[model samples]
Target: MGRLGRQDVAIPDRPSVGYSLLNMAPKHVVVIIPVFRDYDRARQTVAAILRCSVPSPFSVRVHVVDDGSGDGTAERLSEQFGGRIEIIGLPENLGRSAARNAGATNISADLLLFVDADCEPSDDRFLAAHLLSIREADVSMGVVEGQDDGFWHAYQQAARVRRDRLARRTFVAHFTTQNVMIDARLFNSVGGFDEAFKGYGFEDRDLAIRLARAGARFTIAPGARVIHRDTLDLAQVCRKMGEAGATTSQIFASRYPFEYRTLGYEAIDGQRHPWRGVLAKLLWPVFQPWTQHDAWLQWRLVPFKLRAGIVRIMVAVSYLRGTLRRHR
Candidate 1:
């Protein structure tokens, strides 16, 4: 394994690499993938990147950060790819933001492409598209195409609506770290993602907000598409939305008061809705039991429209409850 000549920093319980040598061409980029307890998916993503063909004047190095999976994810990656890819195993689960920050800290590449473990590029031109986009925009956000299922189809449809709604806005409130290419300088300028956002949700949006504030232009690079291997069942989808909704008060509300108020949540006014809270509590037991059912079975039983409606209500109520709780 060849090591780049850069400063070595220790990451507790893991081997550290020196900074990337500056001598490489300007387009030399490092693809950082952060994984937690999903070795197989990570392997596939890495393999896809390695398989992808990039045009000349652009080179790539891959670094996989195992966020304390303790599941031998690091070893499995090493066994499979050997020295072709670098694996950094954290001592404990530090969440996505921390894992990505750690990965960025180790590399000295001018351009950093952050790809989630569960996302694999759709074609060989994925990297090339992102690299080309960086010439015009500071942040090139790629689209994430999910698997062909009712849930994913519904999710995509909803996303289209939001995009249409915000089509004319200066900064559309949408950003996904699932597939994004950012200049290393711009990434560090905004201080990267907020580590405080520990769990599933607005970390990406938060970063985008900060980037926008810093005058970083974000452009869509549809050609740099990736297929997200992981898809949620009705229950999983509800749970994730609820989890994300919960963070609204702490992260979004305080940072973007205008957008927070626009979302129509009472929490923005520092008011608590006791009835909504109680209602959410009552409905919990009913929905709680359903989360355990097989996802495929849930899809089979519920029509797409009905399921979509239910999910929207669940997420909204869950978000309301979260906001109300914070105010209380």
Candidate 2:
């Protein structure tokens, strides 16, 4: 590990190399995809990354780290891609962070692009864009466009965008394990991802916070886009949200005392608010431009009846849980 220094680093707007796709080959760039047991989507994600037209003159290797998926993920990956991709199958499921850490440790590449198993790049230039953007920052994050979740998903996504825009702080709105690349050394310097987060939620944001504190610069690559399929039912979504909330509370309380309230347990102030603080949370919705955008998005793209039913059930469960927690 290199000596840790804290300084504000500015990333250049453009890469040092010219815009020629043919002569841009950088062997130091490695793409890391961490997947957990979703056979079809995982394989397809791998294929998408492999087939992406990288304009950089770099030899990119795709490493797929499996987090003890019980499904036939290993068999399918091995059978399909064979020796073309590197597969690291862990003994147990350790969430997305640990899986990516395992993959990162396996390669000596200077740059590591991490994409989720369910996200596919819009085009081949995604990897190249990531590489080019690395000239100025330690990490580069791309945008996600939802695929099948329909209106509610779009609404949720818009809510996310609005939240990001409202933060006004140097926080990221879409810091998923999908469509991001980081400098291998800098990532490890901050101890990589926190393994305590077992399922989905907040781990990426947590890492980003730590990175910023550690003075790691990040660039948002607007051009590199990915199509994500977040098709979980409403019940499942609520469950995941609850898990994320609980785990995030624990992490913030333990590591960042001042920042814990920002994790959603308290308001921007130091005081802990009542459980019925939904009004405060939702009050600024109109100020968020994505709210209006999502309104149109939801109207135009409502999901099927079955999916809508699932969302209704999920919303009911979330409301009940909130009420019960407050009473307790």
- The model with the greatest lDDT is 1
Question: In candidate 2, what are the lDDT values of residues 191-213, reduced to their tens digit?
Answer: 98888766556678678666666
Task: Encode model 1's per-residue lDDT on 131-185: one tens digit a residue.
Answer: 7766656678888887776566666768666654643342434468989988787
Candidate 2 clash pair list: 11-136, 24-56, 24-57, 25-56, 25-57, 25-58, 26-57, 26-58, 53-124
* Candidate 1, residue 3: how far the Cα is off, in Å: 42
Task: Give the Cα-based TM-score of candidate 1 against the true structure.
Answer: 0.83
> RMSDs, each prediction?
9.2, 8.1
Q: What is residue 220's positional error in candidate 2, in angstroms?
A: 0.8
Whole-model Cα lDDT of every candidate shown, in order = 0.71, 0.63
Clashes of 2: 9
Choose the strongest candidate by TM-score: 1
Could you tell me which residue pairs clash in candidate 1? Answer: 6-19
